[model samples]
Target: MAISSAVQGVSTAKRQRFLRSTVVLHAAAAVTGLVMVLYLLAHMYGNYKVFSGQVAFDGYSHYLRTMGEPLLPRTGALWIIRVVLLASVLIHMYAVIALWRRMRKATAGKGGRRYQSRKNPRGVQRTYSSFTMRWGGIIIFLFVIYHILHLTVNAIAPGGASESPYERVVNGFSIWWVVATYVIAMLALGFHLRHGFWSALASLGANTSPARRRLFNQTATVLAVVITVGFLIPPVAILFRGVGS
Candidate 1:
């Protein structure tokens, strides 16, 4: 009996440590997700400058690269931002994957199926945004790599390669398939952001009341719509209206 008690105590202690680590991962994911959201807003604003014409758009790109001249070398500030964003992306992905694995493990049983709730006909209380979160994240991840290659790196231009960022935007989006791909990716991002924003806030302990929950939900929806629309406009305009042409 004494040996069994000691073994049980050790198990309990291990469970406590596991729970604490999970909490830390949640916090890390929340913080990093928020950081990326801020970056997205800024990036969306920069993208809007494309409507100002090629010179203005390319100038904006140059401004980003030379942001901290004198105080820092050319592209130094940009590199700093890149490093921060990369670190945030890595940490956020790691935390999310770890938490997801824990959730799957906890739910693993009864033929490795998730729990069925009688309260909901679908077996789980899941919003469309939440339900699509994992797949949407995958789409967004793949699109980001393609976006960097097409525009930033000038390595995989769909229409044609160009030194000018403005030309890259106009050239790429001018293609029908390219625009379609972008639209699909943006829609996925919208869904991801809708759920992720609210989830991140909740993870950070912001969903304290029903009122706060409603507000966060509304805010998440608005942000998702705005960011999605904001990104889509330039590409759609370039494709159909010849905004850059």
Candidate 2:
């Protein structure tokens, strides 16, 4: 009785602490996600300007750099947002890693008790979402890193990357192979978002009831389509129409 009581007490204490930390981390992720979504939307719009030609695309980038420049010389708005985004991504990764390790430990501790009984744990399964949880996240993380390096860091982009965003995109996409790579990555992003977008709402408390969950799922679907199409437009335009003067 005493051992069980002690274990119960410890469990409750740990639960309380875990909840507190999760609440803090989740709030940070949600807020930063919304902010990052805004930046991504703006970026998609700017890239979409490729329809008009390189000048229009590059001009849009210049406007982004110089917007509220001398007045807000800190460039604080954009850089600050980027920093927050980085932090949020770190926190998100840590949370998942921590949870994953805990689950792994728990699985190891099971001692094959169920397996020994020959009850098919494999046959009796959970939802599709449960199956994809581990690998899907890793895939998305890899893709996000590639995305940041390709555009944000301007490292992997084509010639004149820093001097001209338009040229970087055109030269990169004109290769055909590079555009195919992006298309593949975006298709993966579409899959990741299929589950993630709705799940995020549940975490953020938007999916309170069954009806709310349905609405949240619909909203997530729409947002996912918007994001996928918005990103694909610029590359499609560049493929059909030649780039630059």
Candidate 3:
């Protein structure tokens, strides 16, 4: 009996440590997600400058590379932002993947039954946004790589290669298939952001009351709409409206 008690106590301690680590990972993922959201907002703003014309757009792009001159080398500030974003992406992905594995393991242990919520009449706590979260993330990941290669690296230009950032925007979006791919990716991003924003806030302990929950839901919806629309406008306008032309 004493040996059994010792083993049980050890198991309980290990479970407690695992739970604590899971919580930490949740917080880390939430914080990193918020960081990426901020970056997206900033990037969306930059994308809007394309409507100001090629010179203004290219100038803004140059400013990004030359930001903090005298205080830092050319592209130094940009590199700093890039490094921070990369670290955030890595940490966020690691935390999310780790939690997801644990969730899958727990579900398997429970005979593959998903936890049900009282709020859900279907006996499942799933939302459309949550349902598509993993797949949407995969789509977004692929889009990001293609986006970087097409625009940033100038290695996989759809229409043609160009040194001008504004030209790149106009050329790439001018292609029908490119625009379609972008639209699909943006829609996926909207769904991802809608759920991710609320989840992040909840993970950070912000969903305290029903009222707060409603507000967070609305905020998440608005943020997702704004970011998704904001990003889509530049490409759509450049393609159909001939804004850059």
Candidate 4:
């Protein structure tokens, strides 16, 4: 009886701790998700300037530094936002990992529902969105790595390039394969954003009911389509123009 009581006490404590952790993770997820979406959209818009060729695009980026004020002091606000975003992303991922471990522990030995097991043998169940979320995250991670090398690290490119943003970018996208990868990455981003955006709102208590969740899901779907189109248009135009080629 004494041993049984001790085990039950531990279990209850674990459950309570998990509930608190879940709340924290969900909150972080909501905040980070919103900020990241905005950051991505801005980044994509800047990249779209590449459609006008290297000079135009590079100039656009240079102009962004000035915040269109034509001033000596660059916009500190932009850099501040970027810093905050980086910090938020770190916190968000940490929370997600914490919650994931807690979930695994809580669900251990529980047989999932039959339909869920069939759909997602890996988890309690796989929602359609869940399947793509993992894939999309993978693509994004890969792209971020390559992107740093090409754009960030100034790695080798089609042209023996200097680190000049202009030289680097023009040389970077000059390859068909590179451009193709950009397209694929943007598509994956669309999938990930589709589920993430709405789900974030839902996590934050924006959509309380099943019907509301469905409505928000449709909204997120539309936003995803917009983001995909917004990203693809400039690249597709550049590809057709053979600017990089």
Full-model lDDT for every candidate: 0.91, 0.67, 0.92, 0.75
Residue 157 CA error for candidate 2 (Å)?
A: 4.4
| TM-score of each model, in listed order | 0.88, 0.73, 0.88, 0.75
Root-mean-square deviation (CA) per prediction: 5.4, 6.9, 5.3, 6.9
Candidate 1 minimal-lDDT segment of 10 residues: 109-118
- Model 2 lDDT tens row, 1-245: 99999999999999878765756556545554555566667767777787777678777766766667677764556676668777777766676566556656877844122322245554443334444655766776787787677766787865346556767777667667767767766665555565666766666888878999988878767876788787877776676665453
Clashing pairs in 3: none
Error of 3 at 149 (Å): 0.6
**Model 4 TM:** 0.75
Native-to-model Cα distance after best TM-score fit, residue 226 in candidate 2, in Å = 1.6
Cα lDDT tens digits for candidate 1, 1-245: 99999999999999878755988899988899999999999999999898999899999999999999989999999999999999999998898888888887877832224457776755566779988987898999999999998999888988788899999999889999999999999999999999999999999999999999999999999999999999999999999965976
Write candidate 4's Cα lDDT for 1-245 as tens digits: 99999999999999877756777689887789788888888887787666566678778766666773544358665567768987887877777667667666777935233443555665456456655775787788788878877775677565457756766776656567877999899889888888888878978999988899889989999989998888777656555655555
Task: Please give the ranking of all candidate structures by lDDT, highest first, separated by commas.
Answer: 3, 1, 4, 2
Distance (Å) between predicted and true CA of 34, model 2? 3.8
For model 1, the stretches where C-alpha displacement exceeds 4 angstroms are 1-20, 109-119
Ranking the candidates on TM-score from highest down gives 3, 1, 4, 2
Compute the lDDT of residue 141 as modeled in candidate 2.
74
Worst 10 residues of 2 by lDDT: 109-118
